[model samples]
Target chain A: MDMSVLIALPVIIPLIIGALSLVALNNHGVQRILGVLGTAAVLVAAIVLLWQTWLNGIKVLEVGSWPAPFGIVLVSDLLGAIMVLLAAITGFATAVYSLKTVRKRFERFGYYPLLHLLLAGVNGAFLTGDIFNLYVWFEVLLVASFALLIQGGERAQMEGAIKYVTLNLLSSALFLTAIGLLYGLVGSLNMADIAVRLQQVEDPKMVTLVAMLFLIAFSIKAAAFPLFFWLPASYHTPQVAVSAVFAGLLTKVGVYALYRVFTLMFTGEVDFTHQILLWMAVFTMLTGVLGAASQYEVRRILSFHIISQIGYMMLGLALFTPLALIGGVFYIMHHIIVKANLFFVAGMMYRLGGSFELKQLGGLYKKHPGLALLFMIPAFSLAGVPPLSGFFAKFILIKAGVEAQAWWAVAIALFVGLFTLFSMIKIWNEAFWKKAPEPAIEVPAPYRNTALYWTTGLLAAMTVAIGIFAQPIYVLAETAAQQLLEPQRYIEAVLGGAK
Target chain B: MTTMMAILIGCLYAAAIYMMLRRSMVKLLIGLILLSNAANLLIFTVAGLERGVPPLIAKGAETVVGGSADPLAQALILTAIVIGFGVLAFAVVLLHRAYEVIRTDDMNEMKGTD
Candidate 1:
C-alpha cells in the first residue's frame, strides 16, 4: 500500500462518509450508523498514521505529485498525528453520545453529515503542510461549524451563530491578509519552504510584522484572553454534541498552528514574540478561570474553563523549552479528552435533572450516585487533582516554568488551578450534593441512555488511564517536543527529495 | 501602478472596518464583503502588479516565460475569493436569519444571548 494513500485516509474517510451520509440524510438510523462507522474508520486510520509516523519520522504526501515548495503537501509528524487521533476519539464518542441526545429532526436536517464534514475539516487542518491549505481548512471547519451551530435555529442559537460567524470570518480575513504578506516576503506557500526562505531574507522586522499578524489571527481562534469573548458568547449555545466536539477540537487547531509556526518558522525574535506570549498566557489563565468561576450555567462554566486550560498550553509554548513543549503537547491531549468528557457529563446531567442551570438543579448524589461519580472523575481531573491527567499536565508545565524561572507564570498557574477547583466544587455542591430546590422530575430507568453513560464513562476512564500510564505518553510527548524544537528534520523530510 | 493599488487597498480596508463598526447588521455584512475584497486585492498588490501578461506556457514549452506574471498568487487570490464568497454568502443568510429571529437589525438588540 502507498504510504501517501494511508496519509490521505484520515481526511478522505470522513469526507466520503459525509457525502454518503448526505445522500441518506432523511434516514436517521442510516445517519447514525454512518456517523459512528465513519468516525470509527477515521479512528482506525489515525491510529495507523500515528503508528507509522512514530515508527518512521514525518510522513509527507505531495498532492498531484507536484513536488515540494510548489505543490500542497500533507505532513503527519507526531504532533499532527496525535491531534488527529484525539479528534477521532472525540468524534467517535460524540457520535455515540448523539445517538441518544440528538433529535431526529436534526438528523433529518443533516446533522450527521455536517458533523462528518467538520471532522474532515479538522483532520485536514491537522495534516496539511501548506500555509494556504491551512486557511482553506479553517474555512472548511468554520463553515461546517456555522451550519452545525445554527441547527434547529432557536433564537439564542441564532444570536450565538451570528457572533460566531462574524467573528470567525473576521479572523479568516486577517489570516488571508497575513498569508498574502508572507507570500510576498518568502515567495513560497509550503511551510518548510517558507522556513528555509525566511531565514535568508534581509529584513527581520518585516518577518516580525507578519508574525504578529499570524499571532493575532491565530489567537482569536485559540480564544486567548481579550479575544475570547466570541467563545463564551457562542460555545454554550450549540447542541451538546456540537459544543463537545467544538470544545475538544476547534481551538486546539489554532494552538497547533501556533506551535507549528512559532517553533518552526518564527523563532527569529523569540525574546520579543515569546515574551508577549508569556504575558498572554498569564492573563489568559487569570481571566478564563475568573470567568468560569462566575458562570452559573453548566456548559458556560465549562466553556470558560476551556479558555483557562488553554492558558496552560500557551504557557508550555511560551516557556519554549523541550520540557515545556512536552507539557504543552501532553496538556493538549489530556485537555481534549477531559474537556469533551466534561461536556458529555454535563449533557447527561441536563438529561437527568432537566436544566443546565446549576442553581435550578440538585440531589443527583442521592438519586443517581453513578452519574455523580461520572461527573467527579472528569471534574476533579480538570481541576488538577492528583493521579489524574490534568494534574500531570499542570505539574509538568509549572515545573517547566519554575525551571525557566518564569515566576509570575508559575504563581498565576498555581492560582488558576485553585479557581478551577473552586468552580468544579461549586458545580458539585450545587448540582450533585445539595438538596433539590424543588421536587425533581424522576427520569425513568429507560430514559437513562446506556450509550451516553458508556461513552462518557469510557472517556473518563481514558483520562484516568492517561494519568496512570503517564510515563509512556510522556515519552511520546518528549519525542514530539524534540521534533518541534528541531525543525531541520521536518524541513529535510519535506524538501529533501526535491530536485 | 503598484502604489495606486496599495492606496486603494488601504482605502478598502479602512472603509470595511468603518462599516463593520456600524450597529446595523446589514452594514456588517457589507463590511465583510468589502473586507474580503480588500484582502484579495492586498494579495494581488503584494505579489506585484503586472499588466497584459497572462501567466502561460508557450506552445511546446516546459514552463511559463520569464516575463509572464506569477500565477501562484493569482491562484491563491482565486481560492481566497471563492472561500470569501462562500463565507459571505453564509454570513448574509446567517445575519438575515438572526434578524428574523431576534426581530431587530440593530446589533445592540442581538445581545439577548450574551
Candidate 2:
C-alpha cells in the first residue's frame, strides 16, 4: 500500500463514518455502532501510521500529485503520529463511554456525526503540512466542538458554548490574520517552505512579532495563563463524555500547535520568544494550580488542573533543549490519559454521589471500594506521585529545568506538584472518605454500566503501563524531541531535499 | 490602493473591538462579523492589488502569465468568508437560544453559569 494512503486513512475513515452516521441519523443504533467502529478504525490506522513513521522516517504526501511547496501536503513525523494515536485512543474511549452517558436525544441530534467530525478535524490538524489548511482544520474543530458543547441545549451548556464559540472565533481571526501576514512575508503556506523562507527573512523582528501573534492565538486555544479563563468557565459545563474528550484532546491541540510552530517555524528569535514563553509557563502553572485549589466542584478542579499541566508542557518547549522537549512530549502523552481518566471518574462520581459539589458528596469509599481504587490511580498519577505516568513526566521536566539552571522554573514546578497533590487529596477526602452529611439519595446501583467502567479502567491501566514501562515511551519521546530540536530532517522530508 | 485598504481594515478592526467591548451579545456578533471582514481585507491588501488579470492560465500555458493577481489570497479569503459566515450564523442562533432561556442578552448576566 502507498504510505500516503496509509497516512491519510486515519483522517479519511472518521470523516466518512461521520457522514455515513449523519445519513443514518434516525437510527440511533446504527449511529452508535458507526461511532464505535469509526474510532476503532482510526485507532488501528493511527497505530499503523505511527509504526510506518517510526520505521521509515517522516512520511510526506502531496495532495493531487502536486509537488511539495505548491500543493497541500500531509506529513507525519513521530510527534504527529504519536498525537494522532493518542487522539484515536481518546476518541475511541469517548465513543464507548458515550454509549452509556450521552442521552438518546442528544445522540439523535447529530452528536455522533459531530464527534466524528471533531476527530477528523483533530487528525487533520495533526497531519497537515500547510499552515492555511491548519486554520481550516481548526475551524472544523471549532464548529464541531461548538455544536457538541451545547448538544443537550441545557441552559448552562448554552452559556458555556457561547463563551467557548466567541473566544475561539476570536482566536481563529487572530490565527487567520497571522497566516495572512506570514503568507505576505514568505509567499507560501507550506510549513516547510515557510520555515525555509523564514531563515532568509531580512527583519527578524517582524518574524518575532508574527510569532507573538501565533503565541497569543494558540495560547487562547491551549488554555494557557491569562487567556485560560474560558476553559474553566466552559469545560465543566459539558456532558462528562464531551468534557473527557475535550479535556484530553482539545487544549492539547493548542499545545501541539505551539510545539509545532515554535520548534519548526519560529526558531530564529528563540532568545526573545522562548524567554517570553518561559515566563508564561511559570505564571500559567501557578495560576492553574491555585485555581484548582480554590475550586469546589469535581470537574472544575480537574479543569483547572488541565491549565496547570499545560504549563509543564509549555515549560518543555520554552527550555528548547532535547531533554526538555522529550519531557514535553512525554508529559503531553501522560497528561492526556491521566486527565481524561480523572474526568471519567468524576462523571462516575456524579453518577453515584448525585452532585458534582464536593461538600455534598461522601462515603463513596465505603459504598464502592472498587470505584475509589480506580480513582486513586489517575488522581495519584495526576499529582505526580511516584511510579506513575505523571511522576515520570514531572521528573523529566524538573530534571531538565535543573540542568538548565532554571532554578525558578524547577522550584515552581515542584511547588505546583505539591499543590496538585493537595487538590487530589481534597477530592479524595471530600468525595470518597468523608461521611455523608445526609442519607445518600436513593438511586439504582451506581455506575453498573460496563462500558463506562471499562473506558475509565482502560485509561487508568494505560497510565500505570506508561509508568511501569517508561523506558520505551521515553525513548520514543527522546527521538521525537531530537527531531523537533533539529528540524532539517522534517523540512527535507517534506520538500523532497529541494532545499 | 493598498494604503486605502489598510486604513479601511484598521477602521473595521477598531469598530469591531469597540462593539465587542459592549454589553450586548448582538453587538458582539456585529463585532465578530466586522473583525472577520477586517481580517479578509487585511489578507487582500497584504497580498497586493492587481487589475483584472484573472489567475486563469492561458491556453497552451502551464501557468498564468506575469501581472496576474494572486489567486491563493482570494481562495484563502473565500474559505475564511464561508467559515466566518457559518460560525456567525451559529453564534446568532446560539445567542438567540441563550436569550430565550436566560431571559437576558447582557454578557454580564450570563456569568450566572460561573
Per-prediction TM-score = 0.98, 0.98
- Per-residue lDDT of candidate 1, residues B1-114 (tens digit): 988999999999999999998999999988999999999999988887778888778899998776656688999999998998898888888887887888898888877667
Q: Where does candidate 2 clash, by residue pair?
A: none
lDDT per residue, candidate 2, A357-385, as tens digits?
A: 99999999998787899899999999999
lDDT scores of the candidates, listed in order = 0.92, 0.92
Query: Residue-wise lDDT of candidate 1 within A329-387, one digit each (tens)?
Result: 99999999999999999988888887899988998898789999999999999999989
DockQ, each predicted model: 0.84, 0.77
